[model samples]
Target: MDTINTDILICGAGAAGLTLAIELARRHVDFMLVDKIDGPFSGSRGKGIQPRTLEIFEAMGVVDRMVAAGGAYPPQRKYRADGGYDEQPSTEGLAPSPAEPYNLPLMLPQYLTEGILRDRLAELGHAPRFGQELTGFEQHADGVTARLARADGTTTTVRARYLVGADGGRSFVRKALAIDFPGESMKMRAMVADLSLTGLDRGAWHRWGDGPGQISLCPLMGTDLFQLQMPVPLEGDIDTSDAALAAVIAARTGRADIALHAVHWRSVYEMSSRLADRYRVGRVFIAGDAAHVHPPTGGQGLNTSVQDAWNLGWKLAAVVDGAPDALLDTYEAERREVAAAMLGLAGKLLEAARTRGDLRRGRETQQLDLGYRTSPLACDARGDDAIVRAGDRAPDAPCRGAAGQPLRLFTLLAAGGWTLLRYEPDGAGVVAPRKGLRIVTVGMDGELRDDGGHLRTAYGFAPGEVALIRPDGYIGALASDERGPALNTYIANSLI
Candidate 1:
């Protein structure tokens, strides 16, 4: 067997894995991403990208492509038994603001999103190695040893400083560690497929019937195909052939005009809500579907998985760069809480779909309100109630550069690493410089001038106050003064 060595070994090249790969690659970390499948997935599963995820993608330098490839969710058209249809908004009512620019979800297929991330990763001199399967792995005090089986019946031994499993629900890494996945499987099943058809309007999301026989056909953005989803009987084998799908659509919609030309990809899955008992075991970790599984109700699975990878990527990079090993512990503490709450929300939404036929998604599904306010890494010395706390997501605002040039707060933060926003009148500061950290003053005579006091209004920062923004875009610490002991202590303990 050939032997390979790397700083990090990431298994599975889905959304979560790809996000992590881009994170590491941009940071110039030595890592390897591998997937068992022969090529990229072609399905249109997990097509909704929430507003919060859009912000993360901006930092990763792929938001422009994602926006161009996606569009707003269309109005839902529910057909009644009398052949008339009722139209209603599919998402909540929210407009774009300076603080929250991307307020609504973007409807982009998962495969396209992964392709953009892959393209970004390749630009950074890395790509996922396909046809490589992780047969098993073992952990040591300082690293992990994994065995990989190739498509040609050959094997390789990999020694990595850390291992991350982004595999699906039945993850090999989670199973090898014997992690307990404790949750209930809802007694329901559904068939999801991508179909190329004709004779149906491509503007609205069309729905037919209700209860256990409801079927929906949603038009995919920038594609000639429609994604079909329908509930399946609980006790029988489902035939996923193209002809069978076409017949079922005809019977459910009571319309012979609609046709199904081809079924590109199809899958039948039982509704389940599960969370791993633990996210980390020594040098090995599990993320994405390996850590939690949810019903396809609120389109939260892929978004949640992306956030999981975002949270872990920075912490892992920090630990590898000689930061305290305990920094890695925060990954589980912060993300596990979020995964648990999202799981419950998805379950409730699934039940509502079955009982009340409610399909309207509210602002809670946007994932903007989720944060790590109670994490051990957050520190606040303001001693006053503020809209944006130490652990909340740092909002963006328009500002002017030192030379009177136009720019946005996100543009500066998107350069990666930690940022210190010092709200002071004078840009006079000789704070000791640190790698991966940048300090920018925002005031009348500072390096960045608040365009219209929007910066202070969004962050609630006083004239002498300062806020530390983490690499993952969360506020790590806030202090009353730039030269405060609280800020120094936070950096010394958590960041250094």
Candidate 2:
């Protein structure tokens, strides 16, 4: 028998695992990722990138490729909610664009998103170990002992200082740790299939709530590519038979006949919102759907998981290399808050569909906000705030360098150190940062600020603003300037 010892053993090489893998790569942390699946992409899953997630990807330098692969535009479209299509596109987002305001949800399939993360991990010189399923784990003070079953019916034991479960809702790690996944499994079931939908807008997303059963038609990368989601009938069985499924759509959409193309993936998912009893149990932790599962109403599943990796990956690396144990606890505190809220928000969105307004009839789930708030750590003057809180993610705005090259605040702030950002060129007169603090100048040309629409609205940063952004991309403070009596002390404490 042979055993391998690694700094981290990540279970489930899906989005959360991939994101954590990439983050560890950036920090030079030694870890291994494993999944039971034979391939990279998974089920008929999530596809929408909420605004906050786009910023995170933009920081990781992978958004461009995601946009290229299958990221779509006009995220909101109308179709019969029960799964037959025939409706015009709809645009209800307050503002959607490509410029500094950074509106618009990036619409790409969930599998493509996972592929992008996996490709980046490989480019960073590591490939996840696939065809391995986690069997069980034993946790000691120093590390965790993990047993895995390989494709060829062989079993191997791996020891790691930490374990992160990214293996989706039915996580083996979560189950092994006896973590309770608490949430409601909804009675309604939704069917998702990626196929072709003609007579739909190529430029916008289409959905429908008017039918007896709620159905949706989403235009994908092009006019010919589309995704269909429909609610199962109240008394319907799990019927995949062609005639019955087609008949259901025809009865709901007033279209007796329709053309069909490739039905790549087809499956049903129950609306659920459940959280682990504890995101962290001893040295074992959970992330993505493993840590928390939610309703898909707001289209936040993939994006939220990516953010979870961003919050946890860096902290895990630091801990493995001898940072304080408190730093690790912060990951659970911060990301769990956001995860809980997202679940609630998704459920609310589903509930909202039951209501209607006078001006816009049949209006349901048409808009989503990139809304985020400040965590206590993001605003704390004390070191105790290391635990991640409800609202914290790096912000982005149209920015230019000293040479006037186009930049986003997130892309340039990954300077391999804690960042101090000031819209002003002079860095809000922040003196020599204690150490490990980087002073980044997000300067404006011949102006103190852009419209409130840019950085201000995206991050709620006011004019003449300055913020101490942590290296892992969370706001440390919002100041007009960094020159304050407690500033130096705060900087020194955060480093060690």
Candidate 3:
């Protein structure tokens, strides 16, 4: 047995764990991410990347590759038992504004997304240790001791300041912690597979039947593949063999003209709308599917899981660098609420899909409306008059830097630290000017000029307003009065 030590230990290398790893790596945090599998996930499990997730990817500095690797959702072509096909508009394209640049959902295979994240992590000089399984872990007041075992029977002991379970729904970490996963066990099950085929047009998402009998084949972007989905019977043993899956597709489509050339992956999936009793137990925490599980409705599972990691990564980095330990407690407080709401929303979508047969992706699924306004970390002095507030997303705006060069608010924010956007000298008293916090004044004669007053309009703030933006691009605190100690207290208690 060997011994290792790190600041954070992440178990599982899916989207959530990979995102967390990339975040910590960029922040120069000492963390280890391990996955039981030998390689990246092969299946196109969660394919829809929501708009909010795209913003998060941009913050992670991988949105360009993501956009290039994926494309917009294809139009839907409905098929009837009589062989008639009805085509529907793919999805509504929302115009990008200063506040919301990525307004439309992106379609990419989950495997490709994970690969892109892994590539980014490699660029940061950290790669997830695959084929390493977390056999068990023990948490003390100060840190956690995790035991990992390799396939050949080699074992290693790792001591870490924190442990995160980004493992799947059947999480060993969650079970070892004895957290209750309470929710409804869905009686419905579905069969899904990725395969290359011939004779079907690769343009639109094809669908057939209705309700539990619904079957669909959607083209996977950036690849010559298609994801086949169909409802399965809850009773009896399901066949996942290539022939069986192909036969089902042929039977469902009522066409012998199509031929399944290659079956890459197959599974019969049962869903549970469950949420963990708690996201944390002392120094050990759970994220992604370990914390919450949802049906494949509204494409919320992977997006929510990635956001969970994003919300947690920055806080972990901050705490490790000398912020208060209580800051870690806010992780559960903030993300648990979001996870619960996501569960409800996914449940509603699932029910609607079953009852009313609605398969369109709407604005609600974009996840841009999620906020932490009700959280304790959100300290808003700017009243309800403003459209934006603390705990809301730090919106992007067009501006010019000190040298008169054009820039964007998000571009400025990616400087890898907290940002204090002071409108002018009126709110200057609240600026503390500390290490790891950048103070950028934006006005006519300020360090950054708000081009066309876009910053003020998008941020919904007047001159003298000071907005403290967190490293995760969320407004941590706001100041309206010139002399209030709220900003200082917020920094001292939560940030410093």
Candidate 4:
């Protein structure tokens, strides 16, 4: 077998794997991304992009394309047996603020989202090696050796300093590691598919019936297709043929006028929530569905998976660059907790869908408030009274550069490195420069001027304070005074 060497080997080139690959590529890290399928995923499975995920994409420099390719979710129109319908706003009363620019979830299909990421990765001079599947991998203290089987039956060996599994729910990597995935499968099943249909307006998400017979047909953005979702009996086998699907729609909606032109993709799934017992095993780690699987009610699965890759990507690159091996442990520590919380939220939404048929998504589903406040890497010299402290998402605010040019905090962070926002009142801080860190002073005459005081208000930091923003766009540490030893200590102890 041919032997290949790389700094990292990433399995399963889905959303998570692609995001990780993009991160590594932008950082100039050597890595390989592989998927079992011959090409990109063609389904519209995960179709909601949350606000937090939009921020991550902005950092990755693809948010513009994503926004252009997608649109806001439409109001859901629930139909009555008499043919009348009631409309409810999908995201009620959520508006974009300076601190949270992307408040509403964008309704884009998963296939399109992956396509955008893949395009960005290709621009970075790399693409996923499809038709190659990770058959097995073994890890040692220093590195991992993985075996890949191609579609043509040829095999190859890959030796890498780290291995990551972004595979789906039936992940071979997780199973091979013997990690316990303990969770109860709900007594509910659903059929989801993409279809070309007629006799319904594309302005609203159309729904019919409730409970076991509930059916939802949502218009997919940027495409002339509707995604169909309906409940199925727990025990019976579902017929996914186009004829059976049309029949089911006719039977449920009582409207023979609605015609199914074609079934683009279809899947039958039983609802289940499961979290891996562990996320890391020596030099190997799991992310996305490999680490946790959730119900699709809250649309958290794909967003959570993308964030998992975002959290792990920078840490993996840092470790490969000779950072302490312990730094990599924080990936599991932070993301697993987030996965557990998101899993519970998804479960609650699933229950609501089952019992009340209430499909209205609230602010909780936006995921803007999720953070690593309790992570070991977080350090806050500021008191607990601080609104935006250590481990919180570094909020964005409109400001001006020294040259009086318009700027945003996210734009400053788009360069992909650690940033220190020093609130120097006089624009004269004797802070020394450090490698791989960009120190931006926020003062009356600093590199960035909080002209409207929006930055101070959003970040909740007074002059003379400093906030250390992680590469992943979270505040790693906060200090009351820039001249204090706390900031340097945090850099030496937690950041490096």
Residue ranges of candidate 3 with Cα displaced over 4 Å: 426-430
Please write out the lDDT profile of model 3 over residues 208-320, one tens digit for every residue.
88877788899999889999988899888998887887798888888898898999988888877999989999999999999999899889999999999998998999999
**Model 2 per-residue lDDT tens digits across residues 404-463:** 456566565665457776655443454574455666654454332353346655554444
| Clashes per candidate, residues 3 or more apart or on different chains | 0, 19, 0, 0
> Per the 3 Å backbone cut-off, how many clashing residue pairs does candidate 1 have?
0
Per residue, candidate 4 scores C-alpha lDDT tens digits across 360-399 of 8988998999999999889899888888989999999999
- Residue 234 C-alpha lDDT in model 3: 85
State the lDDT of candidate 1 residue by residue for 291-335, as single tens digits. Answer: 999998998999999999999998888889988888888999999
Error of 1 at 223 (Å): 0.9
Candidate 4's C-alpha runs over 4 A off are: 426-430
All candidates' lDDT scores? 0.90, 0.67, 0.88, 0.90
- Which regions in candidate 2 have their CA more than 4 angstroms from the true location? 71-91, 94-101, 196-212, 222-224, 233-236, 354-376, 380-394, 397-408, 422-436, 441-466, 479-485
Q: Cα RMSD (Å) per model?
A: 1.2, 5.2, 1.4, 1.1
Q: What TM-score, over all chains together, does every model reach?
A: 0.98, 0.82, 0.97, 0.98
- Which candidate do you rate higher for TM-score, 2 or 3? 3
Question: Over all chains combined, what TM-score does candidate 1 have?
Answer: 0.98
